[model samples]
Target: MAARDYGQYSGITRAMELVGERWALLIVRDLLVGPRRYGELGAGLPRIPSNILAARLKELQAAGIIRRAPRSRVIVYELTPYGRELEPVVLALGAWGFKALDEPREEQIITPDSMTMDLRTAFRPLVAAGLPATAYAARFGVAELLIRVEGGELDVSRGDGEADLAFAAGPDIRRLISGQLAPERAISTGVVEVLRGRGELLTRFASTFHIAA
Candidate 1:
């Protein structure tokens, strides 16, 4: 580490304060795909300065969000299980940031979490442990969707046609699911668009999601 004049924040405050910087989220985003060597993470995030990267990684380690292990002769930075648990939040942030960016015509191929894949991953954690959906369907458009239940997992897609529950939330599914915006409030405010679903089924599906505090 260089002899830079860093501010005197307390250990925990310092850790949170470090990640509070601009490029810190991007550093974690690189790690979310999997582990990476320092250079690889640097390359993936072009805008981050090398020194800043090192500093953030150090802070993340200090905070117990990441750790490095030896591979071959070099060490690799990987998220701790504690850090990996933040993947949903990271994905949510990515989606939200993309929406705030410039026009849709840019054709930038950045995908945070796939709607189809989210369905699969979300169910694996809660409902369907092993098997794939017995029946699956989706109606893809500007806002893609997938409703599926595999093995024993059941999730309704947020598209047209019959759904046990429909989510017509425009742009911010994460906010709604994360409980930042109450589901009923979102529906009432016209922020999220929901479709048909029985009360029992809605309760069952809500159990599967991981909402943020």
Candidate 2:
């Protein structure tokens, strides 16, 4: 069968027009976290050329996925409420990619803030399973973390502890979650450290959440 041109159908053509080219997804990913200036976006994604970045930004704006915010007579790109809805898609795609990659030899260091966010998803199950009769939690990397529950409300805090499960990363949050950080060497010297829960209580809840492999 003769193959049709990708630039033909309106829907297919439009999808291609928006995200078909390289760097488009990266642009979307950058915006997923929060609003960022052009320079910040460019710096975060070094692989994209300036000219291409400008063009793609324009296309995203035209597609109503992003918009400019005014600040001291300057404009910065930010997601529109409609565009902000894509956060789930961006995160889900990243999660899927992480699982598809090879397992690393090193412990993926999950940071304090990122750990809080990760727990937002993973910790929910623990709460649903049954909140401990007392304050139940995990500690890692000289950091103490507690996600306490009572009366259907959630409380989270971090401090000092003989961390039963310590998590640290050799790379940034984006790299780890995206699975670009190599597994074999990443865990070799322990640049990124992960000290999992020790006792049986922590062990039972270990599968509660993960930063993939």
Candidate 3:
């Protein structure tokens, strides 16, 4: 049984009952990045109450959205096939919410999994298809990412690597992706720092990864 019952019979209602809790969908979001151990999930969502995390895990498992599996002799939580189907829905939601995003609160923190999903949400495959293959090493706050675009495919992962462009930005990177800040303007205003590689590629990066805000 789910934690809430709306006394309605509908798909959206059922989904809300299953994953509408404060932290449930966030748990699913992180798991979408990859399998995570119990502690890893906790680390990713630093603000979640331990009891709430435990409860949500149990609820998600009961709803058939996730499962416990052994990897390297250690238990990890991963999305079930049914749960993986939520990827598109999550990405769409991220894009929708991005338009309203403002400055980060002092307590708000960026995690690698969250950044990875954000990139996935903003990736414009059609635009990238018209451009040459490019790689970008980016650091946002404490999270570092290596982003590669080849044709219509976008791949993002943690860590630094050789790339055509390297830059660091805080939350203001949103300004660039939203097209509110041109590459040159962003650089001059200190919204983004080009550490290596061609600075002009920041323009390409903006075009490749964008959300119309």
- For all candidates, what are the clash counts? 8, 11, 0
Error of 2 at 51 (Å): 1.2
Tens digits of per-residue lDDT for model 2, 1-213: 112246566865756666667777667766765577998888767667999889888878887889999867777888888777766765666556655545434654444433444444343344435644323344444335665544445455666344333445433423333444443344454544545543333332333334455
Q: How far is candidate 1 from the true structure (C-alpha RMSD, Å)?
A: 9.2
Q: lDDT of each structure?
A: 0.56, 0.56, 0.93
Q: Score residue 97 of candidate 3 by CA lDDT.
A: 97
lDDT of 1 by residue, 91-163 (tens): 6664455334443354333232234433433343444444333332222225445565555655554445545
State candidate 2's TM-score. 0.55
**TM-score versus the correct structure, for each prediction:** 0.44, 0.55, 0.97
Residue 162 accuracy (lDDT) in model 1: 47
Judge candidate 1 at residue 82 and give its lDDT.
78
**lDDT per residue, candidate 3, 113-210, as tens digits?**
99999999999999999999999999999999999999899888889998999999988888999998998999999999999998999999999889
Off by over 4 Å in 3: none
Q: lDDT of candidate 3? A: 0.93
Error of 3 at 26 (Å): 0.8
